[model samples]
Target: MSRHLLIETQGPWAGRECASFVRDAAALAGGGHRTQLLLLQEGVLGAVPGVLPELDGYLAADGDLLVDRYSVAQRGLKQEQLVAGSRLVDMDEIAGNVLDAAVKVVWH
Candidate 1:
């Protein structure tokens, strides 16, 4: 069976907690699971260019990377400011769709 992982985090990517969250998401995706990362609150910082290069490999592996549009705007960041592979999504859309479909969800 295919498993879906939804990882939600809210903080700067430099923190230990954020790093672990990214690591765990990548590891799970590497193990062949379908993984999606949702960056909210300060966690949207991870979507900033050069903030989290580790996520590149995961994206290359087909993992989905999303940044909350509200969070980006709250931080005065534009869509273009986000990393190349990251997509901007509404929190409601995530909750109604991705979250509902995910087999497991992790928050950090």
Candidate 2:
């Protein structure tokens, strides 16, 4: 059975678990686990290309990742700034996906 992992990262890496969450999720995806990263607020910073090489690596591998478009825009990140394979998702859809998933990991 495929398990779902929803990683909600908020804080910046130097302050909290954001880095760890991104690294772990990337590792999980590399290991063939079903994982997705949802970026909100400062969390979207992790999705910035070239800024986070670990996340960039996972994205290069086609990781299932989502960044709230509102967040991205609010954070001043353009669509081209997002990591590859990452999609823009609405808050309601994010909530629904979390509710429907087997596991939800929030790194706040």
Candidate 3:
């Protein structure tokens, strides 16, 4: 299976597309692809519980959810406030993934 790096920088509050994008990622993972959803900037808001219900399905399908540490601090979000299994990562990690030849990067 191929790997996909789906980078989301906006939250559902920004528009209706965020939730759809997450669902797409979940579908990809459910289809046996290695899909990772990286939430950065205002996208971290989606990491909050109940913000994006699609997150649960995404995680259940073995999709990885990565939240930006800097964004969390900048927005004053607590560690416990994020969704379960969500990983707090640095830019270095994002950079590494984005640079990986096996990863297909998509920013939304």
- Tell me, by lDDT, which candidate is best: 3
Span of 10 residues, lowest total lDDT, candidate 1: 5-14
lDDT of 3 at 103: 96
Q: Which wins on TM-score, candidate 1 or candidate 3?
A: 3
Clashing pairs in 3: none
* Stretches of model 3 off by over 4 angstroms after superposition: none
- Candidate 2, residues 7-106, lDDT tens digits: the string is 5556456564676777777777777777777777777887777666667766655568888888888878887987777788888977787777476555
- Cα RMSD to the true fold for all candidates: 2.0, 2.3, 0.7
**Candidate no. 3 TM-score:** 0.97
TM for candidate 1 is 0.84
The TM-score ranking, best first, is: 3, 1, 2
Candidate 2 runs further than 4 Å off: 11-13
**C-alpha positional error of residue 68 in candidate 3 after TM-score superposition, expressed in Å:** 0.5
Q: What does candidate 3's lDDT look like per residue over 1-108, in tens digits?
A: 899999999888988899999999999999999999999999999999999999999999999999999999999998899999999999999999999999999999
Tell me the TM-score of each prediction against the true structure.
0.84, 0.79, 0.97
Candidate 2, position 16, lDDT: 43
Distance (Å) between predicted and true CA of 2, model 3? 0.4
Compared with the true structure, the alpha-carbon lDDT of candidate 2 equals 0.71
